[model samples]
Target: MIEKCSGNTLKEEFEDVFDDVLIDIGPLSVYYPPGCINRQVSEQSRKKKILRNNYLIKRNQLVLVRGASGSGKSTLLSLIKGIIPDSIFAVIEGRFQFVEPSANVFCVFQNPYSQLVCPTVKEDLVFTMENRGFSQRKMAERLTQFSNFFNLFHLLENKTSKISGGECQKIVLASSLAADPTVLLLDEPTAFLDKDARDEFYAYLAKLKGKYTIIIVDHHQEQILSLADQVIDLDVGIDIDLGKKREHTLVSENWGMIRGAIQENYCICIDKLSFSYAKDAKTQSNFCLKDLNLNIESGKIVTILGQNGSGKSTLLKLISGVLRPTAGNIVIKQGCHPLAPKEYCRHICYLMQNPESHFLFDSIAEEIEFNYRKRGDRSGNISEIFGYYFNVDIDVDVDLSRSPLLLSEGEKRRLTFLMAVLEEKGIMLYDEPTFGQDDASCKKIVTLMKKLREHNRLQIIITHDEKMAYSISDIVYRLCQGRLIDEC
Candidate 1:
């Protein structure tokens, strides 16, 4: 339908450019800045297999592109969004044309933080909308429209960096909708959302299918596949089998399998805990968490699920000492010596929702060596261990010397995750551990969890992936209105 439409017709409807452009980035040689990468795999001397096909995204259809980590799903979006030929960072070597492309093509990247450019939510929207020449009155109208439309009015005053990753993803999406692009490209939109949020957002998108030409790239395929008008499996030229569809089961149905840890092996206790991002506000409605209590056991996998803004991340932060509790006690039973949250961080490894937040070094080589050096292992066996787990073609010993920031979202997650495992922290804390992971990668993580259980290590995962929680978790907790319910 879209291929038949003239550019004039689309511009008339969307008030933005909708050119019939075929993205051809082949023989497509791209080079990153010198000294940027140690391996330089993405930017090789010859044309590597990247967006090498002359693909035309059908108009007015929801096309989903699926592939494993580092597979050009994002780069394809970048090409369509015109980030390739326009940027100074990458040198392109092919004809990438956007025919009669007078209108803008906005993309909500996989990493929501990268797309958000302003300090606060409203400021970010205004900044995005104003770029398309929206007047003050029109921008204000859009700010209120999307914020309230997406149930984000309360967050208008919230700082972009201060909010949780899932909230940031919503804000970025809202900003994209407000921009009203002729082509709306979403890269893993549901990566940060909990199950409820993912369902709700997809339902909303299904309603907007006709209004916007949607192109989504996602690894989680259940609801997304059903919603797509057409599916494009990038790895192969056909729809990838996402396993059989299963009926949704009630979270309460598995209560018998959920068992609590014994007192003697108790890992941590949250006693009358409460936290408020704004402590001295004029009203009492601003509190995020209020007087919650819970207990974690060693050798058990605990999964926490909740809607967006349900204080799930807040609980993890409080336990990890990223944020101090307003009033309450987080006591850790560290080998018979009770320790405060701050003191207990040394014994626990907390993976942030955004993997980039967990990195200390710029290069992957330095990052890996830091772990091995701390243990005084100078042997070449470190690379062997890396190959065994990650199975990447690159020499595990080589630095790739690329900045951790330059790595793809999935690579960053794997790198930080790999380091944490090698460190052998007593307790592991994961916030959205399944983000940027495909089915195989998720299976690897499940296997890793089994290994952790054999050693009696505690794992507390704050996520929305129900299947993952059901697969490995011994205890499941659902967060609602600043409280944790032992659903299992």
Candidate 2:
């Protein structure tokens, strides 16, 4: 049975009798200093309160926390992981009692790459158990069981860097399970996974129900709600709206439409193009894109959909001149003349799937100002551009002094997108652009893409959102193995 205990006397009483109560948190409140809270602040000037009083967690309970981006769901997870006030600077007002040892709690971060420490998949999976002093036989047994469960046997010997984002997340999850933590904290675990892989992951969570205390922070409410025993709305500080559907309504000025400057027709021709990564000694699937042929024109939004590591990202890299083709050719033309490799970056811009990869400056203001000055666009103001596209005011909603690294995953994604738009390139490549965004932010992205299309800019999108793919795409291609098959 779950019991809520408040005050010093009740907490003591629960400690003596309620063995099931794994955590007893009394009138707790957490506050953060302005500009990302990088260090502890003595003065109480402009500090924002992230979490407030009376939060309780019971043993083996499945709790789901929901909120918008930058609403402190991740902050709460860090507190539960015992990282706040020590690893991350935060002001704590009250105490939280953990009945279980801190070692029994494991957190899987929102970004999978953050926790992937080992070089290869196999090593990463076993790294936790090795540090925990598990016997060799015991490690072997757990490895075999989880590898089979997650279908990660094929990727066992592959380097973590070579695998797709979704594969990296799966390996991280497997690594956490192998550690056998009693309390599992997951932050958007399925953010990078495709539909089939995501459904399979949901099934695994169902099977794992009641075995461990699982606290999940995610935007996929419909899929995860069935697994949650109790839900918390962090924004409201109460449990409500267990069955409310998320509404996405974004209205922004059509910046591209306002410009009304249509460029000369550009075309990308891929003729029997093929590319592959260097083969690993024991890897089963050495991902490659092979003998693909396509004709892409300006003023069209083309999307490619496939499973993880199906060479969707490889195609973008090759087209954007980041990687040369192993065989065949890709030619970008204005009217009829082909552009040289040296001129590729002038016309094409690539937004990587990982938002952090785009950051080069410490603060948001610096990052934006640097890119804005480099672009040398005298036509528009930076604040005006941000408002038109992202609907974010430069001075009001965002703290310009904060580090971009301190922003939430969704926030980072939006910032990267804004930087890309600032480049004013004719051709844009986006990889999983909607990965971390909430429904409302996702709508904003769609509106922006549509606006770009109206400006006659060619866009090549790599995504797994089937609904989104079908909605905005003029053409959709599905990649299998190394081959592209037209879906429409």
Candidate 3:
């Protein structure tokens, strides 16, 4: 629980929760200033070095930040959280004075896996309170209160590692709120959630209007924008005279319509497969997929759909050879005898939900080369095709010499998904392909899947995105209560 500041102190810092501007940025701008190493910036990295000046917001306001993938959306939040010139290197051009300092402000990261600590949800939520000197009884009281408020009472005892991506996000939010923050900042808060889950979260956020000064940086902002009193564009400031109107709605590109019918011819077969997680394994897969007989067909997109903690990702792992099945096997067959996922790496490529899970190189160019070399192909035309078809506005033109890990969350997703596409494997398995992408970027991915289908390749996606499943999938398989069922 937040320690109650004296009434005099509250009156000193916070404005009338009614009429005060909680944050004031006088000439807020950032630049590289001068650096010894890598002073040269590429077309993509150029925008990352600049932030439009004089972005302002008021108290009890929800400010939504939007831009293409690499356009400094995340960087702006980093600046506010004091992660910029204070921690990471960057030249600050202006001043940011908050009604509450860093202690009373909470910042959530884009990667859920990195943001969490402690093994169980109970411990993770209490760790911060303990650090703040709260009593054990007080910690338990607040945990129970916030858990109920956040609809997480049922999950308090679960292992944090076993929870789904969406569930993890909920725990992060609950833990942050337990700090009694006057300001809450979230970066891509709903990147892991589906349409239904996002809507549910938006509802929860709306109720916190006057309680906290909320600033959200997200690619999926359509549903949440209704709650935003201010919308800031990092690329361009809040300038109505510059073609950005305050009333404009941010809509994602809709590709719910497909051009042609799909044909079915089995390309991979899963014969009675099951898997269980080893303790603290290199990867986390708690739920199990058991005795699953499945067939993946060419010219069709097969999707794995389920609620959180249903082993949807585990099923993909079994197919990708990340997790060996407890019983049964997976076989890849194009025109030859069946081969397991390990033996048929050339025929299939798996893109993990966490793009960084598969990274093996230090630079973007090297990572691209590693992708092709691992598949035993030396094709040099991928860079060209990637440039030509890369319609994403997320700064795909970044310096190829930089590490892939240096790219923004959205850019990383694009790069990893492209690796599978560029290899042009007969079968590709994508786990949460739409994880960090905005609307237009998601449409581009869907369009690419359509093209792959036309080329008679097999595409299988594991996702919680219902819109994407409806847009690109030809068959949907649901993982329910440890069972995989073919729904359509």
**Can you list the residue pairs that collide in candidate 2?**
none
Count of clashing residue pairs in every prediction: 3, 0, 2
Full-model lDDT, candidate 3:
0.68
Candidate 1 per-residue lDDT over residues 104-171, each given as its tens digit: 68888887666777988889867778889888888888888888877788888988888777888998
lDDT against the true structure, each candidate:
0.69, 0.77, 0.68
Candidate 3 global TM-score: 0.79
Candidate 2, run of 10 with poorest lDDT: 237-246
What's the TM-score of each model vs. the native? 0.79, 0.84, 0.79
lDDT of 3 by residue, 1-488 (tens): 01121233333444455247666654444554345225343222231323445545776678888876666677778877877767777655445655556446688888787777898888888776766778878888999988887678788888888777788887888788787777789998887775566777788888887778888987666677788888876653232223332211111122222223333343778887766675443332453666778887788899888877777877877776767776677777756666655676666678888888767877776776665556463555545523434332222333556777766677788878766665666778888888877776787788778777877878888887877887778998888877887877
Clashes of 1: 3
Which ranges of candidate 2 are over 4 A from the true structure? 1-19, 24-29, 33-46, 52-55, 159-162, 236-258, 278-287, 373-393
For model 1, the local distance difference test gives: 0.69
